[model samples]
Target: MCGIVGVVSHQPVNQLLYDALLLLQHRGQDAAGIATNHSSMFAMHKANGLVRDVFRTRNMRTLQGNSGIGHCRYPTAGSSSEEEAQPFYVNAPFGITLAHNGNLTNWEQLKEEMFKNDRRHINTDSDSEVLLNVLAHEIQKATVDISIDAETIFQAVTVLMRRVRGGYAAVAQIAGVGLLAFRDPYGIRPLCLGINETEQGNEYLIASESVALEGMGFRFVRDIAPGETVFIDNDKQLHTRQCADNPSLNPCVFEFVYLARPDSVIDGASVYSTRLKMGEYLAKKIQREGLADDIDVVMPIPDSSRPAAIQLALALGKEYREGFIKNRYIGRTFIMPGQAARKKSVRQKLNAIPDEFKDKVVLLVDDSIVRGTTSREIVQMARDSGAKKVIFASAAPPVIYPNVYGIDMPTRDELIAHGRTVEEVCREITADALVYQDIEALKQAISDVNPELTSFEASCFDGVYITGDVSREYLDKLENERNNPTKAAKPEDAGRSQLNLNLANEG
Candidate 1:
């Protein structure tokens, strides 16, 4: 998943957008981009790096505008290339610049349709680019004049929503017109609106998470509903419409378990509260199974799992200790490109405190175990740090199915729990004991916070694709394409380097 933010303000928004991206840096680390509109022209800067490293003073100076959109990308759909760094621009039908979060399951078919039927060229393999082109085409069709209004924009989104199939939350800037934001019909990804009452007028901000909005001093408005579209015009007026035939609110459960920041709230449920609830349930399960009898202390894997670990320790009446000191410099190992890289980075990312682990029976809690590479390394580190026994617990249930929505876990073989039992996975990770949260318990954790949340997009645990599109055949195709080395090794185009474009109706 990526992080996308857009705002329409009376003041210049380049720095505001940059600060928001920094708050959302945890969502994506591969690439960062920002695009702004000035005088009906777009100025954009994007590159493959952390948010702070990607944009310099010179780059920020180039982006001068009162309205803009930003994206921090985590490569899930396409190859990690500079060319795919987003705020993808299409210079037709009022010159649109879009930054998107989540993957398009049917991007290949849509790409073919774009070339054969729509006659629009797709520059990169990134699905965000395809989505942008599709929106541009629909807007072109819906418009009767050179100028577009909220009705035409909403109509275009209505058609676009029907054609697009995936868990996506997008923010797009329509040149001089306004900023537009929308979420998929299933609400699989998060998108929330916020307002800042300025002296000049009311400035609106749309973001993938609430933290981005709050960190930028915007008051938390309600989340953008599933299949809903919101447009903020240059005059700072907000126009909204529900544009889907049968919209539902089945948000991705993984966001609470691991993806989202603990401080952020999605769909009216606090992410921090959900994680704490996960810990409580997981603690009870350990108690039921008599696994808590020998545990001397509970320790988190660092960062994301801290909240769950804290609550779990409290419920089990076990001592909670910070055994691992995480290195702030290293990127998250889970989203790293290769197995070797992830495995190697685990050591560099976290170091065990020997005093906390020495002669102690440790219960190590992690958000979830996907490939088991990092888990294995972490377990080994604990053992070597003088722990008598390493009991591993996952706050989330076993991820047995491929998450086609937005997460990076693709092939079945890459998932340690895909065909393995709990004992088998424990052996693979070299943990003395392994415990996982039950699927129902996981669901209840979120619903406990907000009773309105009855369902979730939890395909990884239950294999229930809410979109009704992902099939066994589709999964097999994805696995084959991903597992094949040659097919996955497409090189980045030469001279594509970092982008600093000034697009001005130059299709």
Candidate 2:
């Protein structure tokens, strides 16, 4: 997943784009970039660093513009290379820059089909690159019939939409043409438009979540509906078009579970409350599964589980304790680079507090366990810290299947729980007892809170692909990309990836 922003506003929007990227940092940390049209000159500033790192005081001044688009990336489509960075620009036939969030399930097939059929040479492995190229190709075709105007742009995007089958939300700015944004048929990811209300007029910003808009002093107008295309011109006149017939929301439920920040709102749903309810869901599940009633204390794994642990403690009438203290400088343990060093990483990433652990039978709460590597190490830490017993509970269900979307995760073979039964998984995590929220319970916890959410993308849990069936080729391609991130991240990949690309670049 990635965070994309586009603004067509009254005031010079350098800082607004910069700040929006700050809110979007959680979505992707690899690199950040911005492209703007200032005084009819296309100004571009992209770096393999955080928004702040990329645009320093002197650098930000250079990006001065009234309209622009920016990106922060998490690698779902291509290897983490500078070449794969986003805000991908094509100066030919005029100029265009694009960024995307979510996966294209048919990416490999599309690439293969396009390459074999059209003899199109695809340089970067990133899907966003392919998407931009596809648009460029279509636009190239339309040039014969019409000039690059609003009507031609609309027709080109509309045609391109039909060919793609997957979860996607994207925004871009076409130099001289205007700013364009669109979501896939399923609305697998969230995109909202905010209006900066001022005496001069309303300034429009399109972002992945409402929080970015709110952070930038813009009141959210509403989310761009699923399968919808929005074009906001320099003059601020706006156009909306819907794509495909089957437009059910099916937004990634995992966004609340892990991806989005606590403050961000998706399809009108609260990420913070949803996590709390996931804990509630797990608590009830454990009760039904017949876990012992008298647990000494409920302890969170720190950070991710802290919120859920609070709810779990309340539901079980148990005291909540900070059993583990996270190393703030360290990123989430699961995403720490390589699986080979994951065992050692668990200790360095989190430390157990002896005060809370001594002689206590602690119920350890975590978000979820895909591969049991991290969980086992954490469980060992609690035991080593002197807990008499460690009862493990996850806020979400067992992640048996792999996430075909952007999240970096183990494969079906690597998932400890994929083939094993609940009892089997219980034995693997080595918990005295274990429990997880069921699919039905998860729906009960979150659905009504957001009426705008037409469908929930629980693809990871239910193995249902909302956009379409994911081809085996795409899965293989993703695994290959992960195993070997290209040495030089493609411009689109670097631009969209969230991994702090400057570090990789420096390395």
Could you say which candidate leads in lDDT? 1
What lDDT tens digits, residue by residue, belong to model 1 across residues 109-185? 99999999999999898999999999999999999989899999999999999999989999999988999999999
lDDT (Cα, tens digit) per residue for candidate 2, span 1-507: 788999988888888888999888878777788888876567878877667777888777888779998998766666677788778876655677888887776676778866887556668877887777677777777776535666666677778888887778888777777888988877788899888777887789999988898999888888888888889876788888775566777778778777788787787788888778887877777677776475899888877777788988898788988878778655555554456767777888898889898998888988878778888888888888898888898887777655765666625656677778888988887877878778777766677566555457775676655555653433444444555556432434433322111121122
How far in Å is the alpha carbon of 105 misplaced in model 2?
2.1
Model 2 residue-pair collision total: 38
* Residue 270 of model 1, lDDT score: 97
Off by over 4 Å in 1: 485-507
lDDT of each: 0.92, 0.76
Name model 2 segments beyond 4 Å from true.
112-120, 143-147, 341-344, 451-454, 471-507
Clashing residue pairs in candidate 1 are: none
- In candidate 1, position 89 carries an lDDT of 98
Candidate 1 to truth, TM: 0.95
- Which candidate ranks first by TM-score, i.e. highest? 1
lDDT of 2 at 249: 72
